[model samples]
Target chain A: MSLSEFELIQRYFAEASTDASVALGIGDDCAVLSVPTGQQLAVSIDSLVQGTHFLEGTPADLLASRLFGSALSDLAAMGATPAWLTLALTLPEPDEDWLQLFSSRLAQLCNEYHVSLVGGDTTKGPLTLSAQVHGFLPRDHRLTRAGAKVGDLICVSGCLGDSRGGLDGLLNGFENHTEAGYLLERFYAPTPRIELGKILLGKANSCIDISDGLLSDLSHILKASGGLGARLQLEAVPISSQLIATFGEESARQWALTGGEDFELCFTLPPNYLALLSQLPVPVAVIGKVTDRADIELFLRGEPCQIQGSGYDHFQRKDD
Target chain B: MSLSEFELIQRYFAEASTDASVALGIGDDCAVLSVPTGQQLAVSIDSLVQGTHFLEGTPADLLASRLFGSALSDLAAMGATPAWLTLALTLPEPDEDWLQLFSSRLAQLCNEYHVSLVGGDTTKGPLTLSAQVHGFLPRDHRLTRAGAKVGDLICVSGCLGDSRGGLDGLLNGFENHTEAGYLLERFYAPTPRIELGKILLGKANSCIDISDGLLSDLSHILKASGGLGARLQLEAVPISSQLIATFGEESARQWALTGGEDFELCFTLPPNYLALLSQLPVPVAVIGKVTDRADIELFLRGEPCQIQGSGYDHFQRKDD
Candidate 1:
C-alpha cells in the first residue's frame, strides 16, 4: 500500500513532546510556543532541492542531518539558542525506509539541539526540503554581519574544506580512498556550533556561517559591515588533515578558500578580546584581520597573491 | 543577464523595516524579532509546488496571494495575530515580470496583515514556494482542535465550495463563464480570517481552518477532541451564489461538503456562545452540533444521506 501524507507524518514525525515551551507540536494547524520574556526570537529559513543541494543517491539519514545542520548554522551565526523548527518536505514518492531513517536522524538532532518540530507541510512533488529554525537570545546580545569594524580580528572555528573535499570525492568516485570517509562524514554531518555562537554573543562584532565558502560568506560580512575588507593569511586558514591526505595540500587549500558548505562559524572579534581565545572550548584561528579598505587581499608566506575566482555563484554556468 | 540569488532577493524582497518588533529583517543569517510579553508564539509552514498545489500558468500575483493566505490561515485557526513571515522560493529560472508581480502582491499582503518579511532563501530548482508564518497570542486564549466538547455548536466562517468551484473552472477551462471569475477569485485569493480568529479565541471551544473541505477538516477537530462526531445540517451549509450559478445547486452543495481549499475557519462553540455570533464581523453559519458518537452523520431535508467521499487525499489515485 502507498503511504499517505498524513500517515507519513503520524508514523515517522510525530513524537511525545519533552519541551515545556512547545505548547503544541505536530498535528496542529500551528505550533504554539512560549517565548521567554526579554528575549528576542531569531528565525531563519533554508530550502534544499534534490539535485541542487544533494546527490540523488545521498543517504536519507545523511540528508536529514545535513539539512538540519545547515539550517541551524544560521542560528549559530546569529548567536541564538536553538528553540523550534518547522520542516516542509516534498517527495516524489513515499518510501517507508527512507522516511524512517530521515525522521529518526531529524528527531535526534532536534533533541540534541533542544529544538521541537513544531508544524510543517508534507506534499508529493519533486524532492525538496525546507527548514525554518527559530531560536532566542537577548535583544542586545545577538550577533550580526553588520557589526564588524576595521582592525577587528577575523576568526573561524574548526577546520574547513573537508566538506568540499567530500563533495569532490563523491562526484569524482574517490570514495575508496582511506581518508575519504572522514571527509564524507564532514560533508554529510557538518556540525552547527550553537554553543560557540552563544559564547561569542557579546564578544564577536560580526558573524556568519561558512556555507558558500570562506571567501563568499566572509564577503557577506564585509559587505554588510559597510565597505570593510580583509587581508587573509593563506597558511593560517585551517584545512583538515584528512582533506590534505586525500586531495593533497594545494587542492585542499583551494577547497578551503573557495569550496562551500563548511557550516563553520566565521566571526570577528575586537582586539581586546584576543586574550579570551584560550578559554574557548573549540580551536579558533585568527586567519585574517578586518581592513579599512573595501578590497579583499590575500597573502601567502607574507607575499601578495591574486585569487583566481570568487566563491560559488548560484547563477554562474558550470563551465564559466 | 541571469538573475543571481542575491540580486533576486535584493531587488524584489528586501524592503525598509516598518515593523518595530522585527529587530533585524533580511540580509542576515537570521531575522531577530521581539515577541510580546505574556504571549505565546505560533508558527506554521506551507509549501506549494508547481503542478501539485497550483497550475503551471497561474498568475504570479494570484499564486503569491493564495500561498500567503493559505499559510496565514493556520495562524487564524490558532487565534494568533500574524507577525512575521519568511519565504523560501525555488524557481527553475528567473522571470523578472513574474517576480515583480509576486513580490508586490506578497508585500501588499504583509502590509495589510501587519507582518514583516524576515529572512529566507532563494535557489534555482523546480518551482516551489514555501512560506513560514509566525504569530503571537496570549497563552491561555489560543484555540486548538482538541478543545471541543460533545455539546458544542459547530460553525464555519464565510461561504464554502467557492474555491473548489474556482478550481474546477480553472482545471476544466470554463473560466470564461461570467460567474467563473468570482469562483476563480475565491480559489486564487481566499482571505485569511485573522480578525475572526482573534474574536473567537475565548468564545470558541475549538477551531480549525477549512482547507481539506469541511467534512475532512472538521473530522480532524472531532478526532482531536477525542472520538467526538458531528451531525452536519447539509442544507445549512453556506454555498456561494457564484459557485451555485457556475456549477449548479447539487454540485455546489457537494463541493461545499467535500471540496478543499476554502481557507475558512471552522469552530466549535458552547451552547451559550451562540448569542455572541451576532457580534461577529463576518457571517458564520452554525451548520451542526458536536456529538458523542464517533461517526459523522449528514442530514439533508431532515433525512440522513450517505457521503460518497471524504475529500482530496494526497496519495489517493486520481480515479479513486
Candidate 2:
C-alpha cells in the first residue's frame, strides 16, 4: 500500500498537540507563539535519520524517548525550562505501529517533563526525524559554558558509559537481571538531568550536559573560558558497579573516559556550594578541579595515565 | 569524497554572515534574538530539494533566489516586512563553486529584502535546503485568508500565468527572448509583493499569496471564509500580450489558472476600496466577484468554461 504525503500527514501526524504557549498550532502555514515575559526562549534542533543515526529494527519507543531526551538535555545545560517542541518526520513509508508507539512514548515523556507538543511536519521521504525543542531560561540567570574559573569544582551528576555498554551488550544478545543489565538500561533510557540543572542555576558558574562523554563536554567549558585546565582524579570518577563487574576495570575505564551519550550534567561551582551539592537528589561527583594553566591532566593516584581520545567526534573516522 | 558532518558545517557554513539583528548568530546551541516593539514578528519556513522542487542543473544563484523568494512570499501573504532568515543546508558533498555562488546570491537577496542572516545548520547529506524566514507586521493587522465577505470584490495583483509559460518553454528548450521567457523569469525570481501586502492590510479583507495559481489559492480563501462561489470574467484578468502571442489564448489561460509559483497577491475587498486601491504603487485587477453558490463559474463572452482542477493539487498529476 502506498500513501501520498497529504494522506500520510493526516493518518500519522495530523493531531496537533496543544500547549499553553502556542497561540496558534499546526494546520496553519506557520506557528504563532509567544515567549513568556522576563524569560528568553532557547531552541535546539536535532535530526535523526534511519541508518544514519540508529540501527535497523530499533524499538520505536526507545528511539522516541532517547532522541528527545538527548535534545532536551541541551536545554538542561543552559538551565532552561522545557516549553514546546515541533517534530519533522520524513519516513520511507507510513507505519501505523511505529507512529503509534513513537507518539505514545513522546507524548508520555512530554507530560512527565511538563513540556508540550506544539507543531510537526510529516512528509514522504527517507525515514528521518527532526525535533526542534523550545525552552525558556530566566532573563538574568542563564548558565553558559564560559564561566568556569580556576579552583572551581568540576561536578557531574549520574554515572557514565552505560549507553555505550548497553549497546554492546544488546548487540551481543546478552541480557541479565544483574547490575550490568541495569547499566544497559541506563544507556537505552538515559535520563535528562533537568532537576540537577535548575538546582545549579545560581550555584553553577558554568555547565554543559555530558552528551559526548565527560572529558570532551567538560573540555568545552574549559576551552570557552580560555586558558583554563582541569585536573581529574580517576578514582573519584563514579562508575556503576555493574559496569565494573561485567566489563571489568580496564574496559570500564575505557568506557568512563570515552563513553558517549551519557546525558549527565557536568557543571562547575565555587567552594560555597560544595555542601549544598551533597544534599541533592542525584549523585554529585567532584571528579576534578579547574586550573590556571591550559592543560587537562588526568591522575590515577598522582601518576599520569596515558590520555588518548575521549568521546566521539562527528568528524573522526571510525577506521582511523 | 566522503566528508564528516562537522567538517561540512565548519567549511561551508560557520561564516556568520553579519547583519544588524544578528547580535548572536550561528555556532551557538541556540540563536539569541531581539524583537523590536510596535511590530509583531511574522515567521515562515520552506524546504526545497533538488528534484522535489527544482531541476538538478538549475543555476545556483537562481536556486537561491527562488528558495528564499518562496519563503519571503509567505511573509507577504501575512502583510509583513522581511527581517531575518535561517537556512539549513544538507548536501551530498562539498562543492566550492556551488557554495560561493549560492551564498553570494542568497546574500544579495537577503540584503535586497532587508533580511539579515541569523542562524542555520549545515550537514553532509542529501541536497536539500530548508529555510525559515521572519519579519515584522503591524501589531493589530494581519492579512489572512479567512476574512472575505459575500459581496467583496475579488482583486489580484500583477499578471498571472507567466511562470507556467516559462516552465513550459524551459521544458521544450525553446530559447528566445520571447514573452514565455519573461514569464519563466517571473517564475524563477518571483518579486515578493511585500509592499503591496502591507498597503492592502485593512483594505483587503482576505488575502493569500498566489504561488499555487489563482483559482486554487482563491479556493482556499473561499473555503476558509465560508464563501459560496466566484464569478470570474476571463477577459478582465491582466495578462501579458507576449504570453497570448507565444502560448496562444488557450495555453495562456492554462498558465493563469495553474501556474504554481507566481507569488502574486490574490485578495478580496469591499468595492469602496476601489478608489483607494487604485492609488497604490502597483496595478490591481478586479477580475471577479463573490457569489452565493458553492461552485466557481468562469465566463468568457458570457459563455461558461469550467476549470476541473485546482492549481497543482498535491494529489493530482500536474501537466508538466
Give the top-scoring candidate (TM-score): 1
Cα deviation at B95, candidate 1, in Å, is 2.8
CAPRI class assigned to model 2: acceptable
Instruction: Mark the regions of model 2 whose C-alpha exceeds 4 Å error after superposition.
Output: A1-20, A56-63, A93-104, A166-190, A241-252, A279-281, A315-320, B1-23, B38-40, B57-60, B94-98, B138-140, B162-172, B175-188, B237-249, B313-320
Q: What is the Cα-based TM-score of model 1?
A: 0.96
- Of the candidates shown, which would achieve the greatest lDDT relative to the real structure? 1
Instruction: Encode model 2's per-residue lDDT on A107-206: one tens digit a residue.
Output: 6788788776655555445555666666777766667788899999989888777776786676674344467558656775778888877788878989
Q: Per-residue lDDT for B187-292 in model 1, tens only?
A: 8999999999999998899999988889989989999999899899899999887777777888889889889899999999999988998899899999999999
Cα lDDT, all candidates? 0.85, 0.71
lDDT (tens digit, per residue) of candidate 2 on B227-319? 667899888877878788777888778778777678888889988887977687778899899877776789987888876556763224344
lDDT of 1 at A96: 77
Model 1: lDDT of residue B189: 93
